[model samples]
Each structure stands twice: as structure tokens, then as C-alpha cells.
Target chain A: MTPFELIVREHGPTVLRVCRAVLTAHDAKDAWSETFLSALQAYPRLGADANIEAWLVTIAKRKAIDVIRTRARTPVPVGDVPDGASELGIPDDERGEVWALIGALPDKQRKCVAYHYLVGLPHSEVAAIVGGTTDAARRAAADGVAALRRAYATIPGGTA
Target chain B: MTNIEAPNTADLDRLHDRLVHAADEAGLLDLAYRTVDTPIGRLLLAATDRGVVRVAFETEGHDRVLGDLAARVSPRILNTPKRLDTLARELDEYFAGQRLGFDVPIDFALSRGFRRDVLGHLAVIPYGTTESYAQVAVATGNPRAVRAVGTACATNPLPIVIPCHRVVRTDGSLGGYLGGLHVKRTLLDLEAAA
Candidate 1:
């Protein structure tokens, strides 16, 4: 059996990206950890020849859904400031805005982009995780990316 | 697709370590483990819900050790070392000459029969004393288990903690250790100097 440590080192960054694509940086970080913890616990039973990336992405999607549920459960803060309309720098503000843009996509397309584009899953595998056919998964990702382009070009450095 | 640069993930490395703590707090990690650098070499430290389960040498093959654990113990194991904090600290202290005996609980679920009985006697051999395999066999109530005692020490899962290094040849020479003769000699000398 492959040592679980190797799995964590090898796929940790990609899994983090998957989590970040679907949730906030902070929440994504937590989800990533939970995914690995769950993965490690289940690693022994994970078929030796299983597609590891697809398995990990499936866990990430489940974890991302949990993150949304946790946020929904918490009492909302009074006067949580609305997002400011401002040009963003590449370092900090740009990333936040980019996440906001991607997060705004419809659920199916958002997952398609997250799993396919960001996490780099093939359309076939992405479909398996997102629950659709390969053609549908690819189209959702294409439409999601196109939407990202149009909406992003309206904001300074959005496309960048 | 629009080019979205992979955001700087330098934070993820730090976050991975922190997340282990969070995972532990949330009761997610079933078996926690980490690799520790010691005088001998990098040792793989693994623990179960009961206590520390496996301490492995590099040459013993960490992957093989973990595989055995995954099969024998629960498959739900993670590399979260927080559960082994005390064991790690005690090991560090032992190496530093500040501790005489291990104060950590150990789980021997992976061993059975004569091997388990042999390992149980291996523990109380004291810090600086050496016992011949024949003596150990006799002590364990199986005088003919001399070779069995040797095999038991050679396959010891938690070597340093259980003090298998204290077992020697009947001729008063070091026989063999799972961590190799050099490691056995090193531990023996370390105790002698202390």
C-alpha cells in the first residue's frame, strides 16, 4: 500500500485548489484538511488502482457542500458590509474578487469549472463527480468560463 | 477558458499542519502518525485510538509497516502526529539523557501468541541492562523459545520504546536488532554512557 503521507504530499495542492474554487480561502483550507483526514482514514480501503484524483475531487465537492451548509447554519452578522465595487490588485484583492466571480456562477456550472478547470479533472470524471454526462459537463465548463470572461472583463484586472 | 492564475498557495503548507490540529479536535483522524528524525534515522510513528501502535525504522520499510497497520488495525489512519506528542517528547527526552523510562501507553494489537508474550517481557529489561535471548525465553516461561525470543526481538514493531535493543546473544555479545546491529550497538552504548 502507498504510504498515506505520500498521498498527502503529492495531491495536497490540487485538493486545496479544488476546495478554494468552491469555498472561501479559510473555509477551503478547513475543507481540504477534512478531506485529507477523511481520505487518510479511508485510504486503506481505497482500491489500489482507483483514480485518486477523481476520488479526491469527489471528497472535496462533498466537503465544499458542507462548508456552505455550515455558513447557512450560523446566524448572520448584522450589517455585514456588501462587497465594494473597486478595481483590485493582483495579490490580495484580485483573488477575492476572482473567487466572488466564480462563486457567483450557477451551481452546476460552478462545480464544472471548479472540478474541470481549476482542479483539472477530465470532462468524463468531472461529469461523474458533478452528476451528468461528459458532453454536459464540458458544455457547463465552457459556458462557465465564457460567463467568467464576460463578467470579468467588466471589472479591471478580472480577466488578468 | 479565461486564464486564472493559480493563487499563491504558500499558505496551504502552514494550513496543512494547522488543519491536523483541527481534524484531531473534530474527532476525524482515527490513526495519527508522523515521521520523526532520531539518532538512528527517520522513524515512522503511528498510533491508534488506544495508544502508540507502531514505531518503525527506515530500513524496515515505512510503507510496509503502515500497510501492516492498515490491515491489522483500523484502516482509518492519518499522519496527524498530535496524538503522539507525548511519545515524541518522551523519545526526545530519552535521547537527550533526561528520561530513564518511557511513560507512554503502547498498543500491541498487531502482535500475538509467543511474539506478544516475548515483547511484554522485553519492556521491563531496564534502561542500561542487557539480557540474553535465552534468559528472556526462560523468563517468558518457554525455555525452548530461545530462537523464538530472537525472532520476536527481530520483528519488534515498537523497538526503542519496548527496549528490544537490550536483548543480546547468550555469549554476552549483541545478537541482532530489527533496527540493525549498528543501531542496536548505538542504543546499548547510549545507555552505557548515561
Candidate 2:
């Protein structure tokens, strides 16, 4: 088995991106931590030929859901939640604008887009995580990206 | 879109720090390691929660050592340097000739049986001195196990910290060093100069 450190180094950023795309920044960090912790615990027994990226993405998806479920139980004051950019602590950048756009996408579309586009998993794999047929996953990601394109076109001085 | 870039380097670094903290808190960081540039070479220092466990030279192939650690200790390892901060400082002090001995905690979980016992006796070999394999074997209460003593010193998991470089052949020749004969001579020369 490869050293667990190599696993973290190789896949950490992609997993973080997937987590951030699916959840808030604060919650994304929590999800990322939990995902790797769980992965480390089960890593030794992982087969040599296992798809490490997919395995980590699958774990990250579950951890993201856990964070979402926990957030559902917490009471929030009305109008207290900040927009995606400020909440992610990168308010001034265009990347923040992009994140805000992704965050606004419907849940299934956002997850599909994240799994398929951000990290480059196939729609079939995205479906395995988000639960739908491969065809559905592909459609959701396409629709999500289409919506982003439309929104980006409307931003003043925005380049494609 | 095109702006959906990879997270910035600072962001990834912060996330990694958070992950290391969380892993440490959750007791999942079974082995933490960092490399220290030494007069001899870059040494890979690794620790368990118990204490510093393995100190490897670059010549030993750091990747190979980490693989052995994963197989022998636990695979739940990470490159979290905080755990080895004290040990690294101690190593710096020792190499700079400001310190004679390490006061840091050590986990000898990697060494076993007579090897472990032989390692225990190594610490008392003192600075700026050398002991024959026969002398060490006698000290470990197995005078005839001279070869075993040599083996122990050769396989010393914590080399410089444990002072395995202080051991020599009965003929007053440097028998062998896992770090290489040149490194052995360098260490001996360093201590002798100090």
C-alpha cells in the first residue's frame, strides 16, 4: 500500500474542491477532515488496484451529506446566512463569484456538476454518489453549466 | 466555467493544517513525520504519539522507510511536522555541538528482543567516545552475542539520537554504518572535534 501521506498530497486539493462545491467553506473543511480521517482508518485494507480518487470522492460526498444533515438540525437566525463569496472568506475575487453561481445551483445539479466537471468523475460515478441514472447525472451537470453560462454572460465586463 | 480553478495554494495549505489538527484530535494520525536538513544529510524524522520512533537518512530511501513504517506500524500516517518539532530542535542542538544528549521521549516499538536491549545500552556509550561490539555485547549481558550487538547497532531505528555511531569494531575500525561509512566517519569526526 502507498503511504497515506502520498494519498493526502495527491488527492487533497480535489477533495477540498468537491467539498467546497457541495457545502459551505466552514462546513467544507469539516467534511474534508472527516472524509480523510475515515479514509485513513480504512486505507490499509484498500486493494492495490482500487480507484483512490473515486474512493475518496465517494467518502467526501457522504461526509458532505452528514454536514448538511447536521446543519438542518441547527437553528439559524433569519437573514443571517452570508452569500457564498463572503462566507467562503474570499469576497473580492472572481472565483468567489463563480462559487456563488455554483452554490446557487439546485442540489442535484450542483453535486453532479462538482463530481463531473470540477473533479472529472464520469456521470455514472456522479450518479453512484448523488443517486440517479447516468443519463440523469449527465443532464443535471449540463443544465447546471448552462445556467452558469447564462449568469456569467450577464455579469458586467465578464469574460467567458 | 474557466474561472473554476483549483483552490489556491494558501487555501490548500490551510485545509491541510485543519486536516492534520482534526486527525490529531481524532487520534487518527498514528505516525507523523518531517524531514530535517542535517550536517550529514536530510534526515527523515517520524514519531508516534508515544514519542520519536524512526530517524532515517536520505540514503536509506525515505519513501522505502515510510512504506516500511506503514506496514510495520500503522498506515494512518501524515506529514504533520508539529509532532516532531521538539525532536527536530534537539537534533539541531546536537549537531551544533550545544547538546550532548537527547531528552526527548522515544518509542522503541520498532526494535525487539535483544536488539531493543542492545539499543538501550547504546545511550550510555557517551559523547566523544567509542565502544567495541564486544563491549556493547558485554554491557547488554550477552558477551558472546557480539554479532547480535553489531546487528543491533546496524539496524538502530533511531540512529544519532541513540548514539549507534559510537560503536566500532573490536579492532578499533569502523565496522559499518547504515547511513554509509562516510557518514559514520563524519559523525565520529564531528563529535571528536566538539
Which candidate has the top score in DockQ?
2
Error of 1 at B19 (Å): 4.9
What is the DockQ of the complex in model 2?
0.61
- The models' CA-based lDDT, in order, is 0.79, 0.87
Lowest summed lDDT over 10 consecutive residues: which window, candidate 1 chain B? B1-10
- Segments of candidate 1 deviating more than 4 angstroms: A1-11, A26-50, A66-97, A104-106, A149-160, B1-10, B13-28
Tens-place lDDT digits, model 2, residues B43-140: 99999999999999999999999999999999888998999999899889988988889998999999999999999999888899999999999899
> For this target, which candidate reaches the highest lDDT against the unseen true structure?
2
True-contact fraction in model 1 equals 0.34
For B85-183, candidate 1 gives per-residue lDDT tens digits of: 888888898888788899988899878999999999999999999999999999999999899999999888898999999989988888987788999
Which of the numbered candidates is closest to the native, going by highest TM-score? 2
lDDT of 2 by residue, A43-147 (tens): 978998999999999999889888888889641112234654366524444577677678878888888998999899999988988897999999999999998
iRMS, model 2 (angstroms):
1.8
